[model samples]
Target: MVRDQREIPVRDRLLLAGVQLLEKAGGGDVSTRAVCDLAGVQAPTLYHHFGSKEGLLDAVVSHGFRQFLAARRDQASASADPIEEIRQGWDIHVEFGLQHPASYAHIYGRVERGKRCGVVAEVEAMLLQALAPAARQGRLAVTPADAAAEVLAASSGVILTLITQPEDAVDPGLSTRVRDAILDSITTGSTSPVSSGGEVTTASAAIALASTLEDAPTVLNDAETALLRDWLGRIASPASSGARI
Candidate 1:
């Protein structure tokens, strides 16, 4: 049985309306008035709750991401292998973007300078958590942070590309190829010997150390911690280390 949406606060009701509209028409076709009309709230009430249309959309995206993370957390419980877990995460992300094209577009497709989506950071943190076991087991060939960045970028690129294609025409193999390519770059192959070379040792050790840093107790402020991650990323992947979160 469906609960009555009106039973929720007006603010939450408006958010729910925005989400439904986004799913139906995508954000490019949605408007503040449309949301208010759908939500059965006056314009003033919408403004009072959300400040602006942009604010409402931001809230909507945040709400969607929280739900997304909860589902991911539940699925993660069945995870056994960290590297395979990363693959499953990529599949989950692609599934999400394809299933919720509008929400995924709002979350990632609208890029701005100096202003990034908070959801990306949250996802990265989640990725790092997934990478922790791999790092400890010496399966990581890059710092967990760096690996997270690479995987996130690759998955985002794949999904965004697929999202633009006609539903029937989208090639599922594209995502798998790209995902495996990025994973290959970040981790040694299943049969390959680990830490057999100095470079491998440096990268893997850097990953293991970086993974432990979150709980290792450091006096570093936010800035210092950020810079420290940058340095570790250099040791892990010199080419793409400078890419910011």
Candidate 2:
């Protein structure tokens, strides 16, 4: 019987190749054949390991999420203040997006449209865990889960825009602005005057604008209205006054 001489595990080899292909051609251009050539493995080995090109993409996204989680955890550990922690977290997220645009897009950009991906939940879990202390201390305005989801979505949008924008485009300061905006929005009515009235002072105005929109029957449905009311109530309570949201 003939035996394969390739000593490396097929799965690992394919994943390594996928990473290389992603680095070279970006996630959208990666192909099974390209990965096979990079890994020095047979086409059958690629299929045996990842089933399909999409499967390989999923693996790449998962791997990127792991790296992202590690970086965020490290950043959070180095920061003592919740506000600084959130700022550092956004910086790390943007850095990852800029550094690994392909992987970042694969994980956050395409996965939502339906892919064999599993990284979103993991990333969300990490975000919630990091924000838990802030939520308890009233430094954040919403439930830990809601805050995590909002922050993740908002930051992902900033990163995606940064990735898709033209290279020569104006330095919109989009990431920093968006990060500070989110923090301010969440902490709008809080006791932290600095977070409340700095350059990001528009957060409170933004909330007021959103509230006005919510009050419009044309804008909000019953469920949406209830959700907005609940959110506002939590942030507007007298006990919550001066409390960091």
Candidate 3:
């Protein structure tokens, strides 16, 4: 098997070596020579395959994120409740970081706002999918996009903070507290479309009616219905405090 690895393409060997280093280092960085030595490849071979150290790091990060998403995909498929599944996702995300801090940090610890990563975007897309069923049912307080953004920010921040501290010194409730609070702000606690209020939440009411209108015949034409749906979305939006449907 070791000889088989040595015979594989240089890029694959480099990724395997980098992942091994990340596991051993616990979020610390490695030198180019270390990766080259682990792969039994020359420095020129590494550079030729990856262009630069940063490029190799990017590939390694993408690889780790892909594996993370794959596990999440299997879990999601076996579950029926979207809201509960979303909460479970938060826990899974934190657990992954604890298990592989170095690989996880490369994917989420950075503070770059404008940069684009396809793997990271896929994670957010999955979150949106989890939230979609609730949103369609008028159980979401905010748009799926807004809720996803909040979840991503809070979960990543909590993991990064935990990884920065000694494992035993970290607060046990921090991740759950942050996750639940953010979720409450975006979704009704129950699967029911309505909140504790008399009928339904204002946002949910508007959203439900809009969806009903979409399904049934209406006096409004296509253009009017489209505009009305847009207006309902804005009213349901958390950022639009004064908006009316």
Q: Largest lDDT belongs to which candidate?
A: 1
Give per-residue CA lDDT, model 3, range 156-227, as digits (tens).
889889888886798979999999899888775555544333234667656556656744798888899889
Evaluation by TM-score, superior candidate among 1 and 2:
1
The regions of model 2 sitting more than 4 angstroms off are 1-5, 36-52, 68-77, 108-116, 188-245
> Which model scores highest in TM-score?
1
Lowest-scoring 10 consecutive residues by lDDT in candidate 1?
Answer: 190-199
User: 123-190 in candidate 1: lDDT tens per residue?
Assistant: 78889888887786556766676789999988999988998889789898999999989988777554
Q: Which clashing pairs does model 2 show?
A: 138-244, 139-245, 140-245, 141-245, 191-242
Model 2 vs. true fold: TM: 0.65
What is the alpha-carbon lDDT of model 1 when measured against the actual structure? 0.77
lDDT measured at residue 153 in model 2 versus the true structure, 0 to 100? 90
CA lDDT of 114 in candidate 3? Answer: 93
**Per-model C-alpha RMSD:** 5.2, 9.5, 4.5
Q: Rank all candidate structures by their lDDT, best first, as comma-separated numbers.
A: 1, 3, 2
lDDT (Cα, 0-100) at 172 in candidate 1: 83
